[model samples]
Target: MLVDIRVQEEGFSLDAELARLAGVGLDVGGIGLFMGLVRGDGGLAALVLEHYPGMTESMIARIVAQAGTRFGLLACTVIHRVGRLPVGAPIVLVLCAAAHRGAALEATEFVIDWLKTQAPFWKREEFPDGQGRWVAARESDEAAAARWGMDGPTES
Candidate 1:
C-alpha cells in the first residue's frame, strides 16, 4: 500500500492528487476524497493553524496507518495546511483508494473523522476588526469522532 502524508503551508491541486492515486495502478477499484474549507462564519476573515512540526506528522501517519489496515486501503494521502488562510480557502484534503467503493469511502470518512479531532493542530479565527481568538472544539465534532469509539486524540 502507498501512504502519502504531508503537512505544509501551501495549497494543493485536487486534479494532481487524484492522478497520483490513480497512479497506484490497475488494482485500485475506487477512490474517496474529502476537502475541507475555511468557513466565513461570524464575520471571520481568516483562520490561522499551527502544529508541532515532526510530532504532528507522526500522529497523522499513525492515523493513516490505522485507517489503511482497517479498510484495506491500497493508497492514501493526507494534506493539511497551516498558517493564515482566508475564508473559503482549502484547509485539508484526504484521499483513500481501495479495492471497492465501500472501503474507499469508509476509509476516507474514517481518516477525516479522526483527523478533525485527533490531529495535533491549533487554530485561531481572525475577524475583520483586527481581532483573533482561539477556536474551541465543538461537541458535535467530538460526537462525530466518538462514533469510532475513541475517547481522546492519543487513542487514535
Candidate 2:
C-alpha cells in the first residue's frame, strides 16, 4: 500500500495516476478515486491554495493514517495544489484500495470530508470584477470536522 502526498505544480494526468496506484492484490474487489476541479462563481478569475506547510502535511498524514486505523484500507493517496492555480486545476485527489468495496468507499469519503476542514488549507478567489477574497470554509466542512472530534484549524 503506497500513499502519495504531492503538490500538483503543473499539468497532471488522472488516468496515469489511477494506473500507478494499483498494487498487488489479484483479488482487489474495489478501488475509489476522486478528482476536484476548479470552479467559477461570481466572476471569479482564478484561485490560490495556501497552507501552513509542515502543519498541512501533518494533518493530512494524520487523516490518512486514521482512515487506515478505522477501516484497515490497503492504500491511499492525497494530492493537493498550492500557489497560483487556475480555476480548473485539480486541487486534491484521494485514491483508496481495499479488499472489499465498502472499506474503500468509506475511506475515500472520510479522506475528502476530513481534508475539507482539518487540512489547514485556504483558498483565495480572484474575482474578474477586480476584487479578491478568501472563500469562507463551508459549514459542511465544519460539520464533517466535528465527526473527528478535533479542534479545527485557526483561520488566517
Candidate 3:
C-alpha cells in the first residue's frame, strides 16, 4: 500500500484506522500507535511550518513507502498538522498494525522517528519572550533518520 499523507490545520483521528486494520490480513495480532501534540513550551509556537505542497507530500510518501518495505507491517498511517495551532493540540499521528506486537510497535516508532528528522516541513517556534525563532535543524533528527536503516529521505 502507498503511504498515507495529510498536511492540514485540523486534528487527525486515529480510531478509524484502528478499526480497519484490526484482525485484517495476516491476522494482525496487535497494533501500536503514537500521537504527538503541541507542547506548552514556546519552542514550537515561535515558528510556523511552511511547506512546498506537492513536494512535501511526495517526500513524505517516499519515506513512508520505504518504511513499509523495510518493516513487516500490515498497515501504517501518518498524519501531520500545519498552521497556527494552539498548545496541547494534536500535531502528528502514527499507527501501525502487524502480525506481532513487536513488529507493530517498531514500525510505529520508525514512522514517527523518521518523520521528525526527515520530513521537509520547516518549523519556526514562537517564544513567550517575544523572540520567535526557527528551529535549527536537529542533528538528532538526522541521526534519527539514519538509524531507520534507510540511506535517508529520498531526494526530490
Candidate 4:
C-alpha cells in the first residue's frame, strides 16, 4: 500500500495530487476524495489553524494506518493545511484508492471522520468585526466519528 501524508501552510493543487496517485499503478479501480473548505458564514474573515509539529503528524499517521489496515486500501493520501486561511480556501483533503469502490469509499470516510476528532489541531475563526474566537468541537462531528465504532477518536 502507498501512504502519503503531509501537513503544510501552502495551498495544494488537487490535480497534482491526483496525478501522483495515478502513478501508483493499475490495480487501483476506485478513488475516493474529500475536500474541506473554510466557510464564509457569520461574517467570517479567516480561519486560523494551529498544531503541534511532530505530534500532529504522528497522530494522523496512526489514523491513516488504521484506515489502511481496516479497509485494505491500495493507496491513500492525506493533506491538511495550517496557518491563517481566507474564507472558501481548502483546509483538508483525503484521497483513498482501492481495488473496489467500497473499500476506497469506506476508508476515505473513516480517515476523515477520525481526523476531525483525533487530529491535534486548534482552530480559531476571525470575524470582520475585529473579533476572533476559538472554534469548539460540535456534537454533530463527535457523533459522526462515533459511527465507525473504532478504538480511535469518538464521542465520549
| lDDT (C-alpha, whole model) for all candidates | 0.91, 0.77, 0.72, 0.90
Q: TM-scores across all candidates?
A: 0.95, 0.87, 0.83, 0.95
lDDT of 3 by residue, 1-156 (tens): 434578887776567766766736767788788988767763544346676788767777777777677677767777888876666777788877777888878878887877776677877777666667676887887787677666675754
lDDT of 1 by residue, 65-145 (tens): 888888899999999999999999999999999989999999898888888888889999999999999999888877887
List candidate 3 stretches off by more than 4 Å. Answer: 23-26, 42-47, 128-131, 153-156
Q: Give the poorly placed runs of model 1, Cα more than 4 Å off.
A: 150-156
TM-score of 1: 0.95
Q: How close is candidate 3 to the true structure, as a TM-score?
A: 0.83
Ranking by lDDT: 1, 4, 2, 3
Lowest lDDT 10-residue stretch of candidate 2: 147-156
Model 4, 100-145: lDDT tens digits are: 8999999999999989888889899999887999999989987888
Q: Which regions of candidate 4 are displaced past 4 Å?
A: 153-156
| Candidate 2 C-alpha lDDT tens digits along 1-156 | 566777555656777777766654665567787788888667667898788889888788878888877777777888888887777777788888888889889888888888887787899998777688898878987797677655533222
In model 1, the clashing pairs are none
Best by lDDT: 1
The superposed Cα distance between candidate 1 and the true structure at residue 66, in angstroms, equals 0.5
Candidates 2 and 3 compared: the better one by TM-score is 2
